[model samples]
Target: MINQNKKTYFKERISSKKYGVLMKKIIIVAIFCFFIISKFTPIHGQQEKIPVLMYHHLENNLNSNVVISPENFEDQIRTLKEEGYNSISSQQLYDFLNYNIKLPENPVLITFYDGYLSNYELAYPILKKYGMHAEIFVITSRILEKNEKNSYLNEIPKMNWNQLRAMQDFITIQSHTWDSHYKLVSNNGVKNAALYGPGYINNNFEEQLQYEERVKNDLILSRKLIKEKLGYEPIAISYPFGIKSEDTIELSKVAGFKMGYVIENKKIIKGDNLFSLSRITVNGNETGDELIKRLKS
Candidate 1:
């Protein structure tokens, strides 16, 4: 009787220890799953806003709406520095969006569009002085044509391949599209230029297939040319005129672009679509204070 009683007690104790081990394993797995789920779960009231600022020309052409004077541009750069705004790279922004990478306490992005010579001549030095950086979106068709010694659109001068390569450290060169910088009118009466919109002097309508084909070809050619000339594939494109359609957005992704920037929406928040990002457009007219106000989080 004593032996049997001792055996029963040992069996119960061993079973209890085994049950405790199983409970511990289940608790550990539950904690790990909760941690993973928490990463994707929405926080009650917290959303991060990343501001992307847009600028066109940095030259002193008062008659031109897009041209900003060097003095004013320098002032803007100084203001950003004084305000403790950290100018981050496009890839950093992409990583932050896609990987939840942490940025500075006050993060911002400066973007220059259209591959202007003034960006190298005027803006680069100012940015350097401020210890800042910017992403320059080039109309690849213009750069390629200029390189080929062919006539450019509107006789506008753009940064050549040599200039771009020389200033690559401070400026990230991306595509603004190879040749789809024009407008195309739809089969209906609507007209827009970023992706498609502009019939003719007579406002004729464009066929759907023709518009899609144009977008695809332009994006593919742009990606190919940039890879061939720049030796690295561009990852983003600032929509021409900050205008883009659903079709154009998808085409951008298909052409290997990870992010496509639009003109409006003042601020970029945490959950904004990577394919269609928005920026704050700063014209040459706004004062440095106005630009800062526009960038408010």
Candidate 2:
């Protein structure tokens, strides 16, 4: 009777040991599958953000201080194309931020400020040649009236209504300001450069309100003009001469601008201060190699 009981106990122990080994194998396989699925799934940490480059003027006249030579502009675009860099519009960027739409690899944004006629004349062709899109920030008040060529300060004739409307099909148009005013002031004397800069200001207030009622009015007027002329309101804006204060940013937000661009010299990174977004300045002095280096850095 003792021998029989020993055999039965030994058998039961052997069966339990086999079941344990099988359970261990099953757990290992499940863990391996989980890792494989996670590896193939999309993760937010792996995404990249591209830089937005800002340009002012593109022209053949090298003597012009703010102008970039057409040849250099062409070279820059050609190099970008050769390097497989994809250029996108400001709206596309806005969409990417608002939604999780995946932009093309090596995406870039090219923007021009001041809406100089040279942009429409020279830069437009080059951008079109490369099949790339760009954004142009226009000063609504500076936009030359129909058949009116004479303007103050040799303002370099702005794009006319027809030109602006035509370009709207290819490039995104945004507001710079109604006028190139810096701050809002009441008295004309205070608005003068001797008191303040070449921008507007209100003498009623001692502290400069960068985003005063006057500034908001200008933005509203600019939006109206853009809508009437281009059939759409601008979603972005470039600070005139890259000038802004904390109040100015708030005013811009109130004016319904989704993105505000600045001319600072730095690489714009994720979680960067939105008001002071950095841009690479492209001018006649910068070579293609230098531009590439700046972008890479």
Best by lDDT: 1
Off by over 4 Å in 1: 1-44, 61-65, 144-150, 197-207
Shift in Å, residue 150, candidate 1:
7.4
lDDT of 1 by residue, 64-121 (tens): 3467889888878898889899999889999989898878867888988887777878
The TM-score values for the models, in the order shown, are: 0.79, 0.76
Query: In the order shown, what is each candidate's alpha-carbon RMSD?
Result: 4.1, 5.5
TM-score: model 2 vs. ground truth: 0.76
lDDT of 2 at 170: 64
List the global CA lDDT of all models.
0.79, 0.73
CA lDDT, candidate 2, residue 282: 67
Q: Write the per-residue lDDT of candidate 2 for residues 1-297, one digit (tens) a residue.
A: 999999999999999999999999999999999898676444655545567877777767572336788998888888887878899877777666656456776888988877788888998988889898888888888787675774768567678777887776568888888885344443454332111222432434443454266667777788889999889999887887676766667777888888777776665555556556666666567766767777776
